[model samples]
Target: MNQDDLFIAEDNPQKQIVIVAMTGHMLLDFAGPADVFNCANRALELRGRTDGYRVLVASPNANKQVTNSAGIEITCTYSVMEVSGPIDTLLIAGSNDVQNLDDPAYQDFYHWLSAVDQHTRRVGSVCAGAFALAKAGLLNGKRATTHWDRSRQLQKNYPLIQVDPNPFYTRDGKIYTSGGVSSGIDLALALVEEDHGKEIAMQVARRLVFYLNRPGFQVQFGNLLPVYDHQNIAEKIRSWMIGHLHEPLDVVRLADHMNMSPRNFTRVFHKQTGIPPAKYVEKLRVEAARKYLEDTDSSLEEIAERCGLGGLVSMRRTFLRHLMVTPSDYRRAFRTSLADVIT
Candidate 1:
């Protein structure tokens, strides 16, 4: 079905939502999305309508309750083998226990998961659940994310998959993946918005007392400056860049500060950060400009100068290149509320 067909407005057809849980699963990873969908059903019922979703929890082991990472035991409604679909969305919950993709014990479960994907309309993972999806070969060539700590491992393990560590959630075609624990709520909200209208999703969010919609592209980590443990020379240079964003910092200036040649500085910086020096500088500048746009009512030119983007045109282009949105639009979307602003 097309994207339009996913939305259920008046008729409110029941969508089948299957959550796959495993041993050592993160409770919130499964429960967060469960709460969102359950609340969405309640919202529908308040309008004298039937529930829009049929939620089922399934597990690899059918006979016993699965013990989560938190030591909570939860019973599954069905085993993976029995949960044949017409599934609207199949979500795999994360686990704390490190997974080995090539382990013989998981081979059967992996095969079952791969088969289930064939019949599911949309398949996704919450946090480190991405490991299982990658193991099943479902995430190959797809843009995906997991917890911040696990993203590098995911990328290293599945070289074919594009692992983006920053987003709250990512969707590439019919596959989706979310970052860390609470981001499952954001992913679920996006799914609700996709399956119903924005109004229903907003109602669900309000009921849950959560942000209505945090765009998936929003940065997962808030620090504009890179964190370092030992305060190495490269880290010191990065700290200087953050403090001196308003200056006209070029390769020569940065190299001089580090007392190294421009070529050597660029090479070492890239080695330490996995990004080129120029790109890192642009990222920091854009991140600083983003905060200014969200928090202050400064003119674009003023923000540009303060964030060291040189001018308004440069800032605009940087914002577009890095964030895929204009500064004005980002401000409109993420600006603090008037009530908060007044206080």
Candidate 2:
């Protein structure tokens, strides 16, 4: 489809974009995609055509004010009970509350979702919102993704769903799922591209200041390390190492804690874990630092000190060696809430 393809007014009556805003949902889960669709309309109007996309945000109940993760109250225009028209596109903006089946918020949405699936032209989710679709059984036998941290649990909870944790977004048939908050924007942009082609999509992207239309297959993070078998000190050593990542851990110190000679313990540890004690300790530190960087706003110096990386310079080198990215770069890419800046 070209920009000129939109000049046919009678054919396209504008896609009715219905976004179901879950209670306690991430603000950008719906808002980011909503912005993309809105931008698409702007791109269309700039080409002297009016019909493009009409966005509608709905909550569990009519005119209900739902609080978001950011503590901002969003009053949805329509409730699931009020949504009667045929929807061109349907999306569920995810919430942490969706983890519980007993969550009252899921009640109306799930029932409404299952029924709407028949009439809705396209259906999708953003981040933890995939839980809603999965619960409704819409995602069963479909390739899906959510936030990387929750992807494994999603697969486990709904065994029929093929949950790939890496992608920015995924499309299986008409169902789409994205990695996290900002990834919802990527999914929406892709939908716009499908509807309006590359030129209009590019215009929307440029208007939104998005640098790239990141492909769906790109891995979201590098923290997916192998699950090593620490048969020798399964629980004890791993727990202590995590608790004391801020402290210097030499082989002698570890061996003393394990009640064995340093040389003897090193040999046994290598035989079981397939890695030297020093390298293992370094990997633990990197994992600790990565956690801190992702979940907290701690300064690099403070994170280095906490993770026992000597200082900022040493921490950078260690992260580069282990994760192939500098610590700052890692934080920039994976620290979450890129949507905070975007919105």
TM-score of 1: 0.71
Residue 229, model 2, lDDT: 57
Q: Rate the local accuracy (lDDT) of all candidates.
A: 0.80, 0.80
How does residue 208 of candidate 2 score in lDDT?
88
Give me the runs in candidate 1 sitting further than 4 Å from their true place.
Answer: 1-15, 22-27, 43-51, 60-88, 96-108, 145-152, 164-174, 179-183, 189-206, 209-216, 220-233, 287-306, 324-343
Tens-place lDDT digits, model 2, residues 55-111: 888886545667788888887656755666657888888886654444775577678
Of candidate 1, the 10-residue stretch with the lowest lDDT total is 1-10
- Among residues 3 or more apart in sequence or in different chains, the pairs in candidate 2 whose N, CA or C atoms overlap within 3 Å are 94-129
Clashes of 1: 0
Task: Summarize candidate 1's per-residue lDDT along 154-213 as a digit string, tens digits.
Answer: 999889999988788989999999988888899999999998889999999998889876
Q: TM-score of every model? A: 0.71, 0.68
Give per-residue lDDT, candidate 1, residue 238: 66
The local distance difference test score of model 1 is: 0.80
